[model samples]
Target: MFLKLLSYPRSLIGVIIFIFLTAASAGSLVIVNILFNNRKIEDHIVEFWTRNSCRLFGVNVVVKGLENRPEGGFLYVFNHTSFFDIFAMNGWLGSFRFGAKIELFKIPVFGAGMRRAGILPIARSRREEVFKVYQAAEARIKAGERFALAPEGTRQEVESLGPFKSGPFVFAINAKAPIVPVIVKGAAAILPKGHYIPNWGVWKRTITLEVLPAVDTTPYTIDQRPLLQEKVRQIMAPYFHGDDF
Candidate 1:
């Protein structure tokens, strides 16, 4: 890994442009939300910003297993590693409401856009707030909405799958919706764990998004949530979180 040898100058230029682009994009999204406030149009705006950001940063996304996606009304779970996991999904993994930490929902213009666009914020530490968010999610799922949640809860480097929390699985059981496993690769290398700027190096970085087959949640009650989580993790481990990924 060339790391500093190749990343310094490249990231310097990339980060500078990224800041201006993000500011403009955030302002645009805020205005669009206040004006029309239509989710479909807001989704398009988000897609444009995400996809263009990836393209400009030399993060090429190759999505696989799109046919695995069902019609709607399912909880899509992902393995987290880098912040780009969110960006990559926004760019290439299809349109769906995703849950993000409450902190991201606190950003100035960006947070306002996210809030109005119907993105659910997870208040992980506050039990009452968490319940309310899930209550909202249940209503949306009942209305045949698609939602993506990361069971791992936070970014962690792993050889296969990270340790998963029970909240997402319990939510899936309660909602009685299917689980779609999405495995992401290559983002950790491009942006690393703690860095904000992505390293393009001397060539473009490729990020692969694999949408796995859906797992039915009908049989599992809240008591069987761990079993549900394990089954989905088993399917995802073979394709990601290793050198082959």
Candidate 2:
């Protein structure tokens, strides 16, 4: 009975406050990133923004499988569902970089800020440009920085999963970094894809982050990326449908 009333103006108010706060704060960070070019500041700002956005939007996060994570540089891979996945990750996984779409980099200040923050811009439209993204990611891994990327490449609608891409695995093997598989559930309920505004109907919705064991790339060569990719997918299959992994 109480939730019904919260759904009316409360949801609308939540979305409006979320947009204003995120833009105002993130816009400042973007400009700072572009000017300073400091990775530390970039990470701190991203962590603050991602976590706080979830809070302001009334999204709760539940994290599991942290014991499976290693204490060194790794390639963190996950299934993409909604934009909230980004928040759930950075909010949980500490400091890490990302491989974002090139279009994001073209956004006036936001794009440039992402670049300064060590986010690799992936030009999926250009075949040759893909290698450039891989090269950049490899260097970051070699430098001992964790990177979070989605093998699915883009966000999918609720109750749906997209095909995974193997390029990130190949890059992982080349960098000799461990592959960390993560399964994020319930983001779609908080904020569905293609929706400009978020739903605060229940005041709070839990987004689960399942961090699976890392797949070591030491024994595998670049040529065997597909085999490694398939292994991780199988490990993540049950988790995707809300079953135990």
lDDT per model, in order? 0.79, 0.79
lDDT of 1 by residue, 1-245 (tens): 66556666767777787777776777777887888877777778778878877776677899999999888688889878887777899878777888888998878777887787778898878868876788768878877888889887877764246778888888888888889998888878877777777764544788889888899999998878889888887887777535331
Model 1 ranges with Cα > 4 A deviation:
1-7, 200-202, 240-245
As a whole number from 0 to 100, the lDDT of residue 189 in candidate 1 is 80
- Candidate 2, residues 88-127, lDDT tens digits: the string is 8988877888788899887766666576677878887775
lDDT computed for candidate 1: 0.79
Per-model TM against the reference: 0.89, 0.90
**Candidate 1 pairs with clashing backbones:** none
